[model samples]
Target: MYLEKIDAPQDLRGLTTEQLRALADEIREALLRKLSAHGGHIGPNLGMVEATIALHRVFDSPKDKIIYDVSHQSYVHKMLTGRREAFLDPADYDEVSGYTNPQESEHDHFTIGHTSTSVSLACGLAKARDLRGGSENVIAVIGDGSLSGGEAYEGLSNAGEAGTNLIVVVNDNEMSIAENHGGLYANLRELRESDGKAPCNFFRALGLDYLYVKEGNDIEALTAAFRQVKDTPRPVVVHIRTLKGKGYAPAERQKERFHWGMPFDLATGEPKAAGGGEDYCDLTGRFLLERMRTQPELVAITSGTPAVMGFTPERRREAGRQLVDVGIAEEHAVALASGIAKAGGRPVYGVYSTFIQRCYDQLSQDLCINGNPAVIAVFMGTAAGMNDATHLGFFDIPLLANIPNLVYLAPTCAEEYFAMLDWAIRQREHPVAVRVPGAAVVHRPGPFDTEYGELNRYRVERRGREVAILALGSFHALGEETADRLKTEAGIDATLVNPRYITGLDEELLEELLRDHRAVVTLEDGSLDGGFGEKIARRYGPTPMRVLNYGLRKEFADRYDLGELLRANRLTGEQIAEDVLRIVR
Candidate 1:
């Protein structure tokens, strides 16, 4: 009833403190219902309901631009801004995205999925407003985890030096993707414990004004803090201490566990155990941990997603000897690993393929130019064909492949990944990149040599007369399945070729295939333009190759199931088989 009545922030003006608390409960229940039906960033959104409501009550959205860093916590904001009906209906789940989208609402400014970008974005907005002779408050709601990024610090330093009119709200839940790390968290802890009376200041050191709110969930207190800083001429930092998964008991107990989870039981807050186990990330983590033990010089690092890569806190503690979690700072992690490698140490920086885009400069200059021999493990390299354009990992191979002295390796399965990891470790010639496929599917082990150009050739899964399927990474599975379907139903024996290297095209393998096969079908989980397929077209020019490239188009894809995206792209086994049959006839 309370939620239905709240069409806008003004509706909450007349409500008592108890009624406001009741509204928080209502929001939580709504979130639970939505998340149970359609899985999302449940715990983060639930934790921020009160804080978000308080923010809305104080600041006028659209007029006062609020930029949420890693905007997964902006679900409540969407609900308040006339999108609540979508939340109730499961079919309309696609109506509003999990992260902030400017197209969705005027209140939402920038579309930021990456962490620690709000401060810089907010400062730019504030500067633009001033230039246009307009008066609108610029507020950046960044998580405590985001503060660890070098970019956030760069923005803070700039804001301090320029004296811009900006309000930076640091939502201190003491967690990033996992538990917070770095020196800044210590300062936050001190400020929280001292009740905003601490002498030693991090924000003040950068010449910015500072205010700390010990209780972030206290609506009145948070509203009052906003009121105080409404028209402030100088940039200020509002340190708000809050609990992650505040209302939920299980989430609170296992804060890191519930940070970002799948669909779960509302009663116990435990995730439903999907039958199949052993993620590709887990296998990679185990392999890396085992390798690190024997090779003491080996140092493993991650940006912020240690958990996603299967490096839990327990595993980190057990293998704490050479593990380095640089918080949300990808740039620092890349450069630091390069430095370690330069000093005759083996440093492997394991990061999500999407996030690795941030460290392009470091990858090129720091590692590639120097030929540091740093082993870079790029997890989720192909985007699983399920991600939006924002979450695409397709660019990594193309970008890194062009870098001088960088040898890129694309493995078809977990077994090849482990073998490649071992090979990369032993090699001391150049910088090597191991691209891990999306899922862990079993495959028979082949001869894996560390010699740079050896794995570039394609693996022949089946021999055929007329057609050949050129597949990369997990696309090899689709190719094999397509071959099987062709044999059974279509009576077409298509040759399946697994290209292990995206950059170094196996000229020998391709020449052999082109000599024997009539047409070649290229399949990859990346952009169709300038991808592996295009590369093949360029290599063997204007022959009987008749290369039909199957990949993601040059557009921003929406969030969808991986399998569905594959089917949509005609990259599924049945789809590929049907296409092959048509081409053969």
Candidate 2:
């Protein structure tokens, strides 16, 4: 009832610690309700309630900018910043995003989704504030996982050199999607054990003031710590030790499992699986584990998402696979894979598609130029509405295509992914990049019967003369459904083709389709600008070929329903069928 009356941060300032504690419980209840209705990042949001309240009480947001790393924890911040109704009402779910967005509220300073970018962005803001003669406190709140990133260290070092007034909060819950890796965890252990009086300090090593708060959730203690560094006038690292799922017993018990997840029972704290299905990432991990056996030279590498891919220590040990988890250092992962390849070892670096962007230079120079035969699997290549613009996989196609001697393949189904993985490991010519789309089925199609670079050949889900639909990756299923709908509803025949490869257009197949088809429709899940569809348009320009490109628009897409995102991009089966009917007639 107290939370219902409060709509802004100012409301919390007037409440006592008891009322604030009660309000925290109410916020948790609202979070659980929304998550139960529609799945979201519940664990991080649940853990940050008291800490967020304490920060907002101590510092004035909007005036004193608080940039959250990854910003998944900003749900609590959103509720306090005049957006409480958005959390309580299910109908107004789209009112605020899952991540921090400046457009949503002034309290959210940056539009962030990617990990380990807060420190760098905050340093820039702090420098700008100094230049403008403003003395507003700039705080960069980063997770323990983000601290492993080389960029964060670079930013911290730069901030120290500049002597800028910046507060860097390291929310250490001892997890990073998977368990934490690297030597820094040992330093964190020392800091925690010594009760903030450790001798060899990592923050001080980078020429910054170091302060550790072991009890992060304690509101009074956190308030005191924030006040102590409010006017420190230099870069400071406040290492706060908090449980990932502090209030909830379920999250506290299974640390990595509850790092970021879907809806769960509030009382029992048991997670209800969003969709009853097998994880494609787990499949890749299993297949790789099997492959590592017999192939003694075969090895695996992940930046920080080993557990997400099901490559836990138990799996790794049983499969006898050599896995090198290089923390959040993506650039190191790429170069390390290249080194492994040079030593006559088959190194397969599997990373989330969005996170691979951090190592573009390393991929081009270190691996591609040296011509090392490495296999890089990019999972969740182009899934709409799953991630914000900062985490979109739209640019992977163009970015990978430009590299010389690099073979790029996009798998539409799970079977093809496994086959591609098999082919990539045996490959000795050059580096191969496989883009795996999200929500792929496990249907085993007939043998591929073609080598790599077969070019934009249609999968031929169905045959028709009036209209031909060209689908890539996961969009092929949509194309097949659209063809079926066209025949049933509109009395139209549609031809569907799945192009496994996105880099080079299959000129031979395109000519064949163009000869008989009245219209050609290209469907992809990435951005339209410089995407696969645009390449097709450039190849066959103005030849009575009506090429309608269906993909993500050139803008920053925030979180929304998956179905809505597909429909908005004209990617749904029904929408494609209707578009084909309009174009054909």
Q: Which residue pairs does candidate 2 place in steric collision? A: 456-506, 459-498
RMSD of every prediction: 2.3, 3.0
TM-score for candidate 1: 0.94
Q: How much is 111 displaced in model 1, in angstroms? A: 1.5
Which of the numbered candidates is closest to the native, going by highest TM-score?
Answer: 1
lDDT of 1 by residue, 374-460 (tens): 888887777563365457676776677777778887777777777777888777877888887764555656765445445466667
> Which sections of candidate 1 miss by over 4 Å?
383-389, 445-455, 485-492, 561-564, 574-585
Q: After aligning candidate 1 to the native by TM-score, how far in Å is the CA of 147 from where it should be? A: 0.7
Q: Residue-wise lDDT of candidate 2 within 199-233, one digit each (tens)?
A: 98888988899888888887778888998899678
Local lDDT at 78 for model 1: 87
